[model samples]
Target: MADKAPSGRILVVDDEASLREVLTIMLQREGYDVETAADGATAQALLRESDFDLIISDIKMPKITGLELLRFVREHAPETMMIMITAFSTSEDAVEAMKLGAFDYITKPFRNDEIRLIVRNALERRALRQENQTLRQELSQRYSFANMVGKSEPMQQVYELISKVAPSKANVLVTGESGTGKELVAKAIHFNSPRRDHPFVPVNCGAIPETLLESELFGHEKGAFTGASGQKAGLFEVANSGTIFLDEIGELPASMQVKLLRVLQEREFRRVGGTKDLPVDVRLIAATNKDLATETKEGRFREDLYYRLNVIHIPLPPLRERSEDIPLLINHFYQSHAGHDVKISDAALRLLLDYPWPGNIRELHNVLERCLVLGSAESIGVDCLPPQVRDAAAGTLLHDLPEDGLDLDAYLAAIERELLLKALERSNNVRTRAAELLKMSFRSIRYRLAKFGLDVDE
Candidate 1:
């Protein structure tokens, strides 16, 4: 078999020409690209010219010492790994070099095996660090505001609110209907905040049984309860210095609400069966599809706790209200799931836009994925959609009217504007052709366009 290509680049720095040559030859034999530097200054020059995965240097050298070179590497290329070599009599210098960011150290009378093992371990650590850094960057980009997929005014407002609130320590309460992406908003805030490096713990208040709620939030000591098994940390303790997202906060029982409020006010809590209070510093982000304010009035939720969690409020608009964003969201999900090769027919796109998405973005994504997977490989047509989506009628819109009621005039106007826009899109923006598509006379279409502030000569 052919020899494997060099896996890592190594720079060997020593004042002794013989030692440098020996170390270089040994590393090169192990399938590493190796370079020799006669002194610390020469090593610095080589580092500027080329990148090295690992650096091995002699602690005792003239002009610039190994410790000095280590410091320089730390400030200039902190990601690069370094190892130091020192005489047994001057081992303390090796210890100092370690403090100065050297990866590891070896004594002068060391075996080649010892050098090889330490060098391999240091290179492995460097590779792991690089991998972790890359993953963090990808996650940051994935949750960024630019990736949220909306250009409507309502979504723009949401993006602005999240940006302003992410840097603060204030608690946030996100209100929206089911499938409106409340958890997504929570993640965007946490990832953009200073606590991005720490854990992002999510707890579903509705999912966990009431009996285990307290212990889950405040952990339990051994024998605290039947299934205690051993001592364990709670979600709050686990989320220290980061973020804890509480979904369906409205579902939290009355008893747990009091304890949660205390934690919010005191910043400390004792374990289920322990005495000492454990201090926790975490940002709280709560989400609920229910009207918490109304729940408080109806005596179902505590008003004080509601105020505490509502320090900052973010209300997400339902998909029907932001219908203009549907096409953008569809394109985003399509590109993400099916790539550019699969296409969605214009007729299918129109039905998707007309359908009242009561399940919101989540439902849209699932439908698109299903179509791409089960439908034709080349295109997603009307037949690819579920019956509910394909047969969606104008009456379905009335079924989702808010409990508080809506302005009939404003609601009808929105529908009319949307239909007009769709017609214009289908007709390639020609007003006369758009009127024909909508089955309206040119005069009527022109008057309606002027009324909606969308008047144009063409």
Candidate 2:
């Protein structure tokens, strides 16, 4: 099954001594490590003695029937697969064998290739099940709440909010800049909720074409449109009894917004061209990078729809606002992506902390991956960083001096003015945050604003 010799341990049981030897020799020749038993009782003794990947047994045997052995295997070692051998005239018994949990049944006088192929398929299925179990365990560990990674106060608040709202049936609105892990938070909520065992479907509102978005969210009947070939279930139907995350919800067209609101209000929708309304029990989680409240005020977004979706708002702070979390996030990404053998130098870390990550966590991950791939040294130093990050750290607070010998006083004033504007922009025009960015008290910043004839209200 694994594309190599010594595939797996197999047990061959039969009443006929010649058939047992033939099966044992044939399985061994095909690269399986095989053991033989004379009957069901002996096979049970062998099962107790050791584990086997597969067991091929004759249905009619003295002491115990293969069906009885099937029950024993199901009770004791459910993972071991059982294949039944029945007489060609007893086809009904083969169907009964399947019902009793037999992996497959081979009629007597069967080809050797048929038995080999069935065994191979059974072993492959076993291997696949084991792999899926391992992968699920790993994913559960990765997305657990404790692994969210942030000691900052704002992040702690986020965790608290998530813990409180995740188990509820409320529709959640997540607001954050691009690459701020809005979808990750949505997943955390869904995976930690009661409907975790069900599906979690994610759709990007901005990515899909507006013309198809309505049908994409709601099912379409056969011949619904010019190119409609057959009936198709939409994402809402697909996410029944689970969660559906709409990312970049702000980009949803006004027409679709009305439909989405109707679904949220009525808990049901009909197919694009069908008369029957389908009810869904999906938990809605919407995310956006835009200010929906402002959009509502500006008439760009519907006020009622905004209120409906914003039942519980979770706002994520930008990386600049939570700079303290930078080191932890960097270490997390490094440990996750790069091998533990490599280390980031103190100088490099400092530069990374100082750099403005406009692209947020996603950008930081890319930068670290680039450094690890390009650098040969064990330690990642400032030299390993890209020009944008390295040069940003090296740039002075003031602009470069010109060769024309400009006036010192005017040059200093211009530098101060530009830095103030930049700080204001970075802080979303919040006076207090701008003051903090420039390392000035709020009162001092106000006095400077007054001197520049700038309106504080603006």
Candidate 3:
């Protein structure tokens, strides 16, 4: 679901300058920001001056061998990635390098694509470890909370409640914004509690209609409904010894809400149009974005049902509240967007930090995907952005631009041409919104797009 790849620096060392240059070029072609050294000694000196995400060195270097460098990396730069390179092509060297903490190994005359893939894979592993650390940190932040990503004060309260009731069979109600990742918290509780290995089945209460929601939650005998040609086990039956996540619980219709409340009170329910009362042994974890309490007060949602599902509550904050992590999220996306060491400009970083992000984490990711695809160049700039992003960036980082009195006509014209053609390409000669972003909406933009005769869209 996430496309983050490791994108830190890598130290490439070889006794031969030509080989070093070739390797650097190959990696740079893949969007990696690379630096090089001619020998292990030089590589070590660079390590002293800077930190690297990973290292690639020749096994037989001038003074210090790759193995020695690996030893130094293991002790001094424990997190650094060390890849041993050699002409020897012996498994012994590969085994030795790995034992000494080398992330991977490659021999001389390596294909360009192979080198890129290996570095990408190694860096991805490193990124995962770093992200896991972030999750653990969140645990402490959301301390006593069930599994989730944020550790804000609100999350801490949720954590406290989860810890108190996870071991018991009490029902829970988790509330938050739509993208708040509540299901993650539900699984965390089920897995952490006594039913760690038991099944954790989830059902969206809002997705099925009122007439079918009951059957969906409590199974149905054959021909119970128009489409019920065969008997089907309901969610509760499937999750008998485990947990059931009732997502969007507020959307449950009033008729079904009454039936659901009965089950919570008696721990039993009969299938639709069936005479058998089936007892269920399942833990309930329900979540919704609505304030069921307010709905109850307004006589919209049921009060008894609200009380039944509200025994333990957890709420997650929207991503903007955790805006401090925007940079980390940007880096996280950059690493996973399927490229080598794609770097973001400081201006872009500043831009991402200030966006209102109405869609929260989901919007941030969408913006990042657009940027990655369109701005694969070494550096991303304000002009590279979609207009809204550029506008957002300008809003947050506005300053008095000293009148330099320069005509941006040539630059603007070239960009307009590109956008027009891009639009034409997408519509197969039609100019539309997709093309508009590529070209722009100004009269001058349309004029230039015409100048190129790119009127692809009829």
lDDT of each: 0.87, 0.84, 0.74
TM-score of each: 0.84, 0.74, 0.53
User: lDDT of candidate 2?
Assistant: 0.84
Best by lDDT: 1
Candidate 2 lDDT tens digits, 1-458:
55663279999889999999888888888889899988899999999999999999999998898888999999999999889999974677788889988999888898998988899998888787778878766665666566797899999999988889988999999999998899999988888888877889999999999989988989799999988899999999999999999999999999988889899999999889899988889999999999999999998899889998999999998887788898788677667776454566655666676678899888887887787788743567654577677656436446676575545543344345556767888988889999999999999988876654444564
Which is the leading candidate under TM-score?
A: 1
Candidate 1, residue 283: lDDT: 98
Task: Give the per-residue lDDT of model 1 (tens digit) for 1-458.
Answer: 95343279999999999998889888888889899998999999998998999999998899999999999999998999999989874678888888888888888877898988888888889989999999888887888776898999999999999999999999999999999999999999998999999999999999999999999999999999888899999999999999999999999999999999999999999899998998999999999999999999999999999999999999999998898898788778777765754566655666776678999988988898888787765677665677677556334465877686655654465457668867887887899999999888999999988765566656
Off by over 4 Å in 1: 1-6, 394-458
Candidate 1 pairs with clashing backbones: none
Order of candidates by TM-score, top first?
A: 1, 2, 3
By descending lDDT, how would the candidates be arranged? 1, 2, 3
RMSD of 3: 17.2
